[model samples]
Target: MSLTPLNEDLGVLRFITAGSVDDGKSTLIGRLLYDSKSVLTDQLSALSRAKHKRTAGEDIDFSLLTDGLEAEREQGITIDVAYRYFATARRKFIIADTPGHEQYTRNMVTGASTAHAAIILVDATRVTEVDGQTELLAQTKRHSAIVKLLGLQHVIVAINKMDLIDFSEARFNAIRAAYLELAQRLGLQDVRFVPVSALKGDNIVFASEKMPWYQDEPLLDVLESLPVAEQDGELRFPVQLVARQDGSQADDFRGYMGRVESGAIRVGQSLRVLPSNRSATVAEIVGPSGLLDQAFAGQCVTVRLAEDVDVSRGDTFVSTESALQPSRKLGADVCWFDEEPLSPQRKYLLKQATSTVYVRVGSVDTVLDVTTLSHGTDKTTLAMNDIGAVQLSLQKPLAADTYDSHPATGSFVLIDEATHHTVAAGMIRTLAA
Candidate 1:
């Protein structure tokens, strides 16, 4: 099978590593960084002198490179998301090492929210074989389901600890078959498999001679070659702050300041402000360096509209020709993160992009069973770490798009009004009628 060509303009690839506990997520990342010579001299010395070394005979414990928390080191498990940066000659990378435990699913969601791809580490030893059928761990299935729900562009399943299983080709095939079934059920399209031993650095940065049956490129090469998710070419500029210069010597200036979440904006372009449905033409586009003729996605700029319109921090500037519409009712898939169950009666704060509005759960439509990869409508309450589809009623309309089409503007979080804590993360699936 051929791989997708990488987009050189993407510059940096952001990805998250996830799996069950002791599945070698952190170790795999450590191996990638160490094998690619991304580790510095001081870090290497510290690894040698550190006391929590898991490996024997001064064989550097690779997991120490990540797992930086004191409690994480003591427990030998990742509790919080740890971000690390490294670069190869061909591409730069940002890795989010997420916790594998089921309780920390929120952290995994947080890390995966901004990532373009995911590296799911599956322990070969964790799978049980019976009559040529393999059973994957519950956490592994749950992570894969979450990957599909988040709409990740690429998924690389690194079957880790090949050395522990004696590099058996039959075992690898069985596990791959089982995972392929799961991927098909979860609707994961761009999936690739590689057998690796994070401990021994096999098939991580270089091809492992022991696994000669595996003809595919190593994990690093696959990552470098995978295409990044392209942002849609519709302007989505959420107004973060309304800049004003009232007492200046020059004429009074009013500009809407924010980062271009997606798409491009240029002078003379027509834009429609959200919720208000006010139209205006772009008069000036100013960047950090000074005036700019045009600004694309991920750029922070201040825009001056030709006509003064009532724009605020929460207002979004959208392309006049774009299909996105303002809606008060949203159909979304939400992952509950709070200890309290989802209460339709309680008022919650819905924060999407720069806007925060009061919202209520209109109804719980379906709850996902990660093990079976099925949705059930019989459920009512969603406890902590539960994934469910629900209809939300907003006090005000939001200019939003479906998460599958435009992730930056289509995602939101539910905040508890009483405690001021985020209770759930939601992805828009449908709009108001």
Candidate 2:
């Protein structure tokens, strides 16, 4: 299998599924994998046995199929990231199945932070029926709201358990219009809705003939047709190393090495190294298969410059028009993943591109309100799984990209000074002009 690296490669799509309790997110995924013939016979047999046991004196449950944890199985809900991989001819997919309860909102964000798209599952009757689960529909909006804030433009709204409603097209369309309205208000585009019964395997992989009145592509078709996130931007490469591949006689060969973060890289082209604004002409581009005159997104290549200048790791190579300078201070939207709240005065080892520096937390602009999708002005501390915008003052100027411009160079992670644990993932908001 050809592994598409980050830089110019058409790589696998990572997506997540989130829903409220009993919304059938897991069953939807299991049915997708099973109906697509991605499951093993042994696993199917185990499920059969479990199914038999359940039917005889059983609950006829399917949540067992994906609730693969002891606690999750006991509670009958997902609690953490349960990753499953599969592929079709058009693309490969990684599914990060996340829990739906508000308590596991952090887990949902953890799953979604890297996802290219997301599927928010909901039950149809939960919206109309007066019950304790009305909050469930609200929670779906809250979750998708955060996903949009995190920059995900594509969202698939799956209103599942259509069999319970006798496959009413009106019921499905009602929920669909409601979600589309919410999505527009939240600034999310590419929202698609479909009604299905995950338990009965309707409209997941193959179109459900049961819902014949509805004429839309099935969920699998939608996923296959979706655009990949990697193809939406310009090329970026962050230098990870500098090495000398000696000629064995001259001993004076210098080359720049790094994984190409994006775009095509070519040999014999002039590149402007950033932060210093120095220029160099590429003499050769070396890959694992020897020297190639060109490399594209996702290639790890070493480039030899015609004239030797001072170049090192952490320097950025770019097309002349694309060069950007490093900044001594910047703002970031952080997802706090650790137990500790971010201390305003504490220093963290900020890792962005190839540079690491001691950065002080200047101030937290605001903590996002997950429920209302608004800002909490009085909030100063960011707790575990909280998303907030914060500013940082660096000890030295470092090359960076706005997360909106280039994800590779625009993103950074905070390391604990005492334990070295990664406490937060940050998206760079601005760089020096």
Candidate 3:
């Protein structure tokens, strides 16, 4: 059997799979790829060889498809994000398989940040504690909170390994009810629950006859029908490069190159450069095929201005009416990843789009408890994998917006000056207010 290409009109659906360690995230992804016939002949042969290393049963171990690292295969756990691409007759998909361990919470956030939806796996057998107590897993709750905070509207909670439990509807309902309560508290939208067994291929790619109880469509069906978020806002173009393709002659044409972050831009549209506050009219729209009438969100195009303004990399061009405010102080939510613990004493480099500047932690307002969803008053420091609200003082004014308003200009990363390593991912909430 061969994989089929989707209709060109069918847009892509990007989603992420995340759950606690050993919850069958890898196996679920493997089942999707394998059953869809997206796996190549050579890859199937490799899976056959790897199956013996991890499985002793007759059924193929689908988890081998995503556990790419030797350490992960040896330890039997996911360590980093593994991206897989596939297509069906209905829709194309890009799936990011994220790690479930608490230490890798930062990795999960990175994987889910750009995802249009999230698939959270829950092993039915382990939904309860050893004492027969019904409780949600800490890591599971952490991932869910992060998913909501990232503004992902679609969520699927797949109750996997139902075959081992004899496909008990009561067990699935219990977990579903508990998770629904959590989803409500987190304000998640369009949450769905499905019962499945990745190993047995039940309720995955097609309906499972083993249960005969579930009437809803399988996981793949739900995924294909999920709606992607709409990009609705005014034009926001952050200049990445200023090119003079012909030569540096004053008369030679120069172009400001960047991707349109939102809205539409066309020739003769008025734009204001941020921080500099210089205004220019779009004189020409240049694309690979020559001239273009307009450019919209997600398109990369070069723009020429009516007048030669002193624009350079890191400057943002925005719609004259919907320009973002420039600020030196910001209140944001940050996920700290460094083991070095965040403190006000230390300073770091803030990188937002093409702009980079020095910044320091002004204050940490509160730290979130994943399980309880409670806030802890903390103003001094944050540890690894901690999600907290903090205020930042920037060395220079940054053109920014609230994440709820415009995500492209509302997010940033903090880099360690000494190691040049990314220490935090931040989402702005307010600018000096």
lDDT of 3 by residue, 378-428 (tens): 447889999999989999888888888888888889999999888999898
C-alpha positional error of residue 117 in candidate 3 after TM-score superposition, expressed in Å: 0.4
- Structure candidate 2, residue pairs in collision: 7-297, 7-298, 8-297, 8-298, 9-297, 54-58
Error of 3 at 337 (Å): 1.2
Range of the 10 consecutive residues with the lowest summed lDDT in candidate 3: 1-10
The order of the candidates by lDDT, greatest first, is 1, 3, 2
Q: Summarize candidate 2's per-residue lDDT along 394-422 as a digit string, tens digits.
A: 98888787876777788888999998988
lDDT of 1 by residue, 1-433 (tens): 2354444443789999999999999999999999999999899899988888888876878899999998999999999999999987668899999999999998899999989899999999988966757989988998888888899889999999999989999989888899999998888999999999999999999999999899999999888877775795788999999988895757899999999999999999999998898999999999999999999999999999999789999999998997777899999999999999999878999999999999989899999988777899998879999999999999988888889878988999999989998999999999993
Off by over 4 Å in 2: 1-12, 49-66, 128-138, 232-235, 245-249
lDDT, candidates in the order shown:
0.91, 0.79, 0.88
Best by lDDT: 1
Q: Per-candidate TM vs. native?
A: 0.96, 0.87, 0.95
Instruction: For model 2, state the Cα shift of residue 413 in Å.
Output: 1.7
